[model samples]
Target: MASVARSLRKVFVGGLPWTVGTNELRQYFSEFGHVVNAFVIFDRNTGLSRGYGFVTFGNPAGFNSALNQQKHILEGNVLQIQPAN
Candidate 1:
């Protein structure tokens, strides 16, 4: 049997509004491509957004499309999108 290798298709989203939740993040990014998963990091103590999050795409094409945008506006905040290391 052979194992399949998948290309990296995850992006790091920063400068997110504290009010933005996982659902909102997913919804916004869905416009660019098929969002496999999206999540906003939260502070464990306050349960508030950590101002950063991650979005995963089903394929690299979607990831590239999103990366080309470089920046996005959501909830009146400018979001920084970058490829996840």
Candidate 2:
């Protein structure tokens, strides 16, 4: 049998300071669910956050539910949540 790939979602989170790192991002995403992982995309040269990143939830149900209710003002920025590739 083929192993099933995990169901993960991505989010567009902007308005973070350049100092924000993966751990902080993961902690912020934890409010939605059990964050399997979180990372802020960065530029190769400047090594700065690209103003967005991905967040993966360990539980699919929790992830989808979060997509419906999670939004701006709480994080101080409007975040876009969507299915990952």
Candidate 3:
């Protein structure tokens, strides 16, 4: 099984308003880590957020900084930051 720290990089964001896009989410988390990649979950047909997403960082230490500082959020919604699996 993968550890929590690895998972933390791939956070599960929630409660994102309909207006927000994957780019916006990425920009938000980038402050914490060197955002390597970010993908906001979306419906296959509609391409909309299922109110969650994943943010991966280049370095694990950056991920830890984001976690410890509690710097995850988007438009006032506190993110559900956690491991990917």
Q: Rate the local accuracy (lDDT) of all candidates.
A: 0.88, 0.68, 0.73
Per-residue CA lDDT of model 1 for 41-71, tens digit only, reads 9999999999999998887778889999856
RMSD values, in order shown: 2.7, 2.9, 3.2
Query: Which pairs of residues collide in model 1?
Result: none
**Candidate 3 positional error at 51, Å:** 0.4
Task: Count clashing pairs, candidate 3.
Answer: 2
Report how far off residue 76 is in candidate 1 (Å): 0.8
Ranking by TM-score: 1, 3, 2
Residue range 1-85, candidate 3, lDDT tens digits: 4545455566566677767788998888788879888877788998776887777888887677766775555687767666666
Name the Cα RMSD for model 1. Answer: 2.7
Task: Please provide TM-scores, in order, for all candidate models, with all chains considered together.
Answer: 0.89, 0.72, 0.76
Model 2 stretches with alpha carbons more than 4 Å out: 1-4, 8-17
Residues 5-73, candidate 2: write the lDDT tens digits: 354455555666666788988887787778877788899999878877777777776577667874543
Best by lDDT: 1
lDDT of 2: 0.68
lDDT of 3 at 72: 56
